[model samples]
Target: MTRARRKPMVAPKLFSEIDRYDEANSARLGLICIQERIPSGYTRWDREYNLDGRDARLTCISPGEYGGVPHGLDGDFATLLNVLYLEQGSPESGEVHTTAYQLIQRAGFPDSGQYYQSLQESLDRLKGATYTASESWRDHRQKRWTTVKFNIIEQIDSDTEGGTAFGVGTTLKIRLARPVVQSLRERYVKPLDLTFVMSLKRSLTRSLYRMLDAHRYDPANPQEPAAALRLPLLQWARECKLVEEVPARVRRNLESAHAELIDRGYLKSVTYEGRRAETIIVYEFGDLPATAPAPEPMIEVVPDSPVTEALRRRGVAHPVARRLVADFGENHVTVRLETFEAMIAAGYKARNPSALLVDVIKDQEGKYAALGTSALPAAVAPHARISKVVGDEDVDALSATLDTEFRALPPAEQAARAVTSVRMFIGKELREGHYRSLLRAVQAGDVDALELQREATRAAAELRLPEFAEGLRRAYSEP
Candidate 1:
């Protein structure tokens, strides 16, 4: 008795049959297994030379298609394997083979001769079935196989690569297809714009370097290469939605741009520090617009002492005189403080004061600390009706308190207040009676308000804020 046929170790799986056929046919006939959307394809799939060059039937398998045959055929194990031999010539002339197979001996189908039979019987069954080969086929009287006029793109391989040359790149240009761009316009374009800003931080660092170089200054060393200028640059960069950690190369490119600005006379060296010969004076580049001038305290004190005339010959401003007198009651007192400090550090502290004053100017001008001050506190400061005593003894205590308040609130609340401060006049608007209704509308889960919070967080974190806010407004508000 015949030994019982061995069983397949696992049940049939999706694509397992297709996978076996592809591998076996590809290996036997030198067909390629290429990705469906890839930049290349198999010999017969190339199109110019096959008998079925324009047929839809040929093209479907050319790129390869999926989904299994219907289950109604039951245990029938047949496949039609078409190979367009590229080494053969044109449709009227070359050898093209389309063979039908009745696959047998798959261990799971041991008793199924009905499924795998002779080619004649297979052809009869296929013809009897509703699905016949899609295009016209003719039996060759002079050759062993028949030919079909199916859609196939063929190629001529060149001998240099051991096969005929199939111009895949050219054919793709003539016949390639793309999914519609309009269909993805909203889904792709919006997130791409958002991510665009996220990627801009790197670019902004280059701008910072140019801003630094516009002043005719060079980084003295790598460790503090930008120590002289980084802080203010960083502050403004943040305001522009640029952040720190921009690469060093970007920093250098910015420096070079600023240098170009200097070369064009948009910037000038305005003042010197240290001895007249040893000093360095930095200037802003002219290509860039000048921001509001940095603030300098305008203190006027005329000393009633003769020594005031003596100090006047020096370039010292009178404010320095008053600060000296205010710091120390006598001119001699100012001299003593300077002399002692110099004796200890030998002019190091005094040397950098002018540069440090540049920062002090920008700070006092109100650009540096506005988020936690000025526009913010000015909003509610009038309505709160609260006055807490602030002392010069504690310096920035008032600003500090206000900053503490601003930081303590969630970003969303801060954003709402910011919009309110700029747009709403409380008594005029609130007194009109629609104000509370509007406030409730915002508070009752406003989408606009939430969007504003996201924008503000991006602005504050990336440092873009109101300047870049306009660009992003259409992002959330569009119909």
Candidate 2:
């Protein structure tokens, strides 16, 4: 008997790198436009999109060949760029040979007829879609601006039988355009977690992730993370395709997006500087402790109102009181204030009302639990077990010991030890029961194991416990 030939198994590409800031920064500033879906048929137009910043400006103009502003290009086109970026042998080589199946798998798309159709459509769109970008950068010492125009793909060479075998026997040879290739060669790239980016389902969420990844500060630099991007609410709304939405509606969308990002471990927290219409939204990115205190819910409160007066009476500083009243609402503040007043009336002599108030609010851990909100303040929550193992005292002691040891070691040994120390600390949290609780939550169906694992990984980075995070991930994945 003759046996049928079996297809060779393909290993997962798993990761890819791109000029992290290139497309993402442009998207954040309203330069690259994304559409939810491709139009039913071809369309074309010309338009200019502007990305204005404190020290830089980027202007993007859509070419007339492809439908005005390459809609939906960010996802598939980005995936293609990542593939090429990863596979390229040299900076000068622009041609990349990949099978349709390989592209589908790498792009995180399903291997199906519909997906194949969509991929072909995307390729066509990308071929015709071209844009020009004018970038301006300025500082105290110097300023510069430059412009470049390029197509997403300079050319595509393909070999395939026009049969109904979904992408079978199809091979694509893609040559990336010059400008993008040059950008990559010039080291205008930022590191990205391709797995994380590809896993995001929504186009907007993916765009935001790219933007955050592009803007993330290098952790090794030992400086404060980059300043939060502050964008006027209206301008942000326009970029997010909510230009017609009222301020309240826009705020709702922004909050919802922020919560989603926080849950996914891409955001530290989101803060707004002003109220309604004039609001300046700040997107802060960093690792956050799992036990961080929750943010006060946004609610309406009059400026300089009685609530502020009551807080002042309680010895809360003016700025602190104003922030609390604005964020937590009059009703919530009044309740807390009443509780404090009642405590004082009971002959309680308080030396620090401000600290006491903070403690009281924190003690009521379930106050906002019912709201199902994830974005929270950075106040450290009390964790008896974790505190014992990786407390501030332990961290300080470890730092001091490392510093002393470094002085005694030769340069090569010191460098090795420094890397090993960071690696060791990232796994320190494994000793606690946090992973047990996480596993239980996953088994109980309260959360997804993969998502919980991702969260643990992110938290471990901040908490300096990588080994523990890896072990937990293994536990979740293993039978």
Candidate 3:
């Protein structure tokens, strides 16, 4: 078998925005679904219960030869689903395009052979698993609780024009199920702060975050996202597919996950309403941080009519706009909108303009921020992207640009940024002091741009990266 090549790791861009639909509630494959290995003959998962006094049933079955429904690691497919929706452009958009490696990076997993194989397996399980939500699912289009059957992904095919997942140059064409597409058309089914969700340490915590966020947020009133949610403990366990009904067992199962979320600031507290199986788990959300914990809360639910309207004018739904302004403030939301608009004007084709706009507002990639005049690099070119090298001239040009940018900063600030930047690319602390000196040498003209690039590239190769020059260049960029 041919070994899959390693792609260089550039700094992860902030532009990776992910969203999901509420219609697919209770169908969390890996998060809430079984985590154990599936038996060869396994084929289905079914449960019947009451959801808010309504009869609810959930059924997921494997339509393909692949068995046991989408369980275990298939949970990570949530990342792929959000990416698909972010790029889907429209509920009517039958398909979206992405790559295996892109999904892997967004998943925050290491870029290695094992993960590539894991990605492929996850995709197969997701494509094969068909979920049937009976009253448990919401049909936003019809505005009613109804029985709905759909696959999170209707089909997955290798893009003829693009490489498949196992190869270096790969793109996957994913057909979205009709229901999912319909949900995408809505103003806000549920847009996840995937950056925050993905940052969680456990799949269990990640799963809890998604389900709870979906509950706390009310799409119709974006200005006031729900801050608290309460659910029957046993019902919640059943909803999460945690088979244990004993209150003690359920609480024990959730104990660590709840603690992790609280410590991470995603949850302020988790309280119980009763003892034993009769208990009701009450959860309150913490105030949104922009991303992680910035000094100025990056994301907070503030009400702003003007900003919300601006988003609406740009084809963003009233609710989504409100949600944007509510979660992220007016300034951040407006700048990103203007930037995306400017990029479109500059002939940047967007499959989903609204979705892209939503993505950009919350930590967009620097490359996409060019059209806006908001202290962003006028034109931060991708001089050395993953797996590719630039000419000596390109490297020299980047160095010159960095020099000019550096001169404008105070000496102390420049030194601070340089140290921080160099440390990130070095990957290991053992080499930190050496790289600091090396970075100073380049800044002070003791080293040329090409040599520094090669040195960094060689170091990257030691870590199994094919072309790590991207890291060397990206290290200097602070965004």
State the lDDT of candidate 3 residue by residue for 10-50, as single tens digits.
Answer: 22122122223333343332223533344655577677866
Question: Candidates' lDDT values, in order?
Answer: 0.26, 0.46, 0.53
Cα TM-score of candidate 1: 0.14
lDDT of 1 by residue, 18-123 (tens): 1111111111111111111122221122111123453422112321121111111211212121111111111122212221111122212222324333322322
Tens digit of per-residue lDDT, candidate 2, span 251-350 = 7755655776777666768887887788887887644224543221111123478888776665543434555666667766665555445444544443
Q: Candidate 2: RMSD over Cα atoms?
A: 22.4
Output the number of the TM-score-best candidate.
Answer: 3
Question: Which candidate has the highest lDDT of all?
Answer: 3
lDDT of 3 at 467: 37
* Model 3 collision count: 5
Q: Which stretches of candidate 1 lie over 4 Å from their true place?
A: 1-256, 263-265, 268-415, 418-440, 443-479
Cα deviation of 31, candidate 1, in Å: 62
